[model samples]
Target: MLDKKRIDCFTCRHFYITWDRDFRKGCRAMGFKCNEMPSIVVYQNSGVECLRYEPKLPRKQK
Candidate 1:
């Protein structure tokens, strides 16, 4: 069994979830577009290569 918490990269001390613009940057760096959902880490205490994490954007509604 696994325990998962609801949080983002900026909040957690580990993991990194890429945002829209940064997602693009990551894609460019990886030489591929971020088409497979812009998530960098989905695990706790995972090692990260991201040091430029920013807060997650507020949700938008139609």
Candidate 2:
């Protein structure tokens, strides 16, 4: 069983903000938008943690 509690969609590479009234959040890897975090939506419908989650790389300092 996957522990979905520690999953933070904000730190994921695929996470995005849509600016939509209804669906404000989105995932590029899974290709879906939602009012809440995309990971929650995926887990709720699929009954499993998001498998496509990839941590965003840190930006290099100038």
Candidate 3:
């Protein structure tokens, strides 16, 4: 069994939803877009946790 780290791309600041239908998600920090989540792609490629995973800041309501 392959061990997978639990990384949530949506919580990272680099994660962004794209307008493209095929590749809906992208990572600004890595400068790439993919159908899979950025963190998952990074982990699969590098076999390690993402180095640029920065947590998104809480939005302040006006």
TM-score of each: 0.21, 0.87, 0.86
List of clashing residue pairs for candidate 3:
none
Residue 5 error, candidate 1, Å: 5.0
Query: How far does residue 33 in candidate 1 sit from its true spot (Å)?
Result: 2.8
- Model 1: number of backbone collisions: 0
* lDDT of prediction 1: 0.36
TM-score of 3: 0.86
- For every candidate in turn, the CA RMSD to the true structure comes to 8.6, 2.2, 1.7
> Could you say which candidate leads in TM-score?
2
Task: Evaluate residue 38 in candidate 3 and report its C-alpha lDDT on the 0 to 100 scale.
Answer: 85
- Of the pair 1 and 3, which is ahead by lDDT? 3
TM-score of 2: 0.87
| lDDT score of residue 10 within candidate 2 | 94
Which of the two, 1 or 3, has more TM-score?
3
Tens digits of per-residue lDDT, candidate 2, 1-62, equal: 34636579999999999978899999999988999888888888988888999999999999
Candidate 2 RMSD to the correct structure:
2.2
In the predicted model 2, the residue pairs found to clash are none
